[model samples]
Target: MLLPMSIQAKSYGWGFKKNTNHQPPDVGVYKNILDDLGGYYLDNSGDKVVYLTFDNGYEEGYTGKVLDVLKEKKVPATFFVTGHYVEDQEQLVKRMVNEGHIVGNHSYHHPDFTKLSKAKMKEELESLEEAVAKITDQKEMQYVRPPRGTFNKQSIQWANELGYTHVFWSLAFVDWNTDSQKGWKKAYQQVMDQIHPGAVILLHTVSKDNAEALAYMIDDLRKQGYSFRSLDDLVMKDILPEPIIGF
Candidate 1:
């Protein structure tokens, strides 16, 4: 049995205990809070649908490969990007939008929303949305991945009021430290071992291993009977009740 978790309005660095049992992570009260706020980390449809998301702060030359793999595999993904990435890689950002992928906001300067005022949080999101809008066909950004996975109840509430949905991850690993990458196999195994139905998988575009393992991972996950979904699909599925869908 799981114990009830108490939530506070204070700043929180988002994290949860990973389960070897390959289940949706135990996010305690965080999940409930997000659920009520129209934010989500897991698909509630109880189906074998997986949403792939990537955090691109500043590219390390592997995003193109990742994009190529996604294109080849015909998988849809959401790329949450920072202002620095947009300023640095406008073409890549355009490509992400042009190739039928959703580009999400990771904030303009990549600051902790929990530390910013409501106005400033809106500014951060709107600024990134504007930057992305300038370079792509996406005129609006609807999802946000808080910088460094940090947020508070108030921060999330502000994002909600600002028309952005907070997107946290149910599956992730230490693939961000560019200096400590193990290998493609390790990345593949880590994801395979942790994947679950309705999971929102977070991968960093800076990870070379992730760039290399993405294709294989897609194939294997498809073989496991999992379907790839976009964040738009995830949110739409959520908005429409389970029974009402496909009726």
Candidate 2:
């Protein structure tokens, strides 16, 4: 059976317009797709709250600093980590959990789940879950962010069957490129200009630019009357009930 045309696999590109009074049309479209599939991209609660998330595929000498900023600011955020990150950065992962932050599963090897069979996909998720559990003392892993922001109906369904909620970001920029660091000023402008209520913001833990601007970003966002939220507090309460398969 095929997914509904609205929920079919498509490369998720995070984008939005600046100085808008209403939710961007594209955001609404993506939100509906995730809503139908029991997933989430944006919070859309009309509150001045934003959910912060970081993708930690591997350590790049900046996660510690990022965590430091988060701790200093006392803002809760989620870290979606891979097997390599968990194995190599056990201390960092420990700190994340110890400091009241959520550690989410980003798969074992960071493969595009859309290209894998159901069993392979399960292994990818389960292996990472097992690693996180071992490190966090078997804390239940519930959130899954598809590597490279890619997914499909089958993969999402398989994840939900295993009691995982898929998370995609609603706001991200070209900060992943290490060679082309956009400087802290550009990073600050991009994030602050696009700030919106109930937005799921994605930042790479490896970006030095993000590290430099994180504290300032938090302060500026707060100045603008925005607050930070944890994904557990945001998505879990908003998830829709599982839809019947083969509709």
Candidate 3:
């Protein structure tokens, strides 16, 4: 099946949207392309499962607390850490692995991967993989979330060739700006209001608001019959048809 030009155009600048109705629009276009290319944006499991992920570019002061909450709740999450985070906080990264959390590659420098050449992109992934392997002793890092939520078809295909499953979120908010945090109540509402089945919720460990509201959010999500899953569990395998070359 040939991809529509409109879908291809949209893929270059696709950003996640928070659906109030909890129904993401015509993602088949995106999903079909990703499934064939070994990438993923949303999980359409139709079950009450939320894949919790955090983008840890660099630790602020809250990742430990965030990890503590996840530990208390016994919820598994994927933490996509940059090369700097791994280098600076080796123990924390080790703790994440020891605690049974999946550590994903967020690239070495956190550059907009859509802008890099295939070689540079591979370096971004490989350097992080080497660092993570040295720290966690887990040689195979299967998941990656592109920096700034920006990716193109070519970038996805390159990542696929490198044996990565690109992970994009189905739910996210403006929580990266620490100074702009509205409060825990507002954060809670922002997440709960858009909560849906099979939501890949993106949170930043840098946000104090997220640290404050995460436990409450977990409780509420469970009350609404949603359970958290790691990216390892949510990733689909053998679902893609033969690779469509030259995207």
Q: Which of the numbered candidates is closest to the native, going by highest lDDT?
A: 1
Per residue, candidate 1 scores C-alpha lDDT tens digits across 1-247 of 2212233346677889987786788998787777766688888667888899999999899999999998888889999999999999999999999999999989999997877878898888898999998878999989999999998777877787888889999999999999999999999999999999889999999999999999999999989888888887777774666532210
Candidate 3 C-alpha lDDT tens digits along 10-96:
435456545788665345456666776766666675768788899999888899999999999999999999999999999999999
- lDDT by residue for model 2 over 1-247, one digit each (tens)? 5656565545454344444343532654556557677877777667777889999988779998998998898899989999999999999998999998999889999998877877998899899888887877547888999988777666777789889999887778888888888788888887877677777888998889999999999998888787887887675445654421110
**Residue 224 C-alpha lDDT in model 2:** 76
Between candidates 1 and 3, the one scoring higher on lDDT is 1
Off by over 4 Å in 3: 1-11, 25-29, 236-247
Model 2: pairs clashing at backbone N, Cα or C within 3 Å: none
* Ranking, lDDT, top scorer first: 1, 3, 2
Query: What is the lDDT of every predicted structure here?
Result: 0.87, 0.80, 0.82
Collision pairs in model 3:
none
Stretches of model 2 off by over 4 angstroms after superposition: 1-25, 239-247
Task: Name the best candidate (by TM-score).
Answer: 1
Report clashes for each candidate as comma-separated counts. 0, 0, 0
Model 2 / residue 51 / CA error / Å = 0.6
lDDT of 2: 0.80
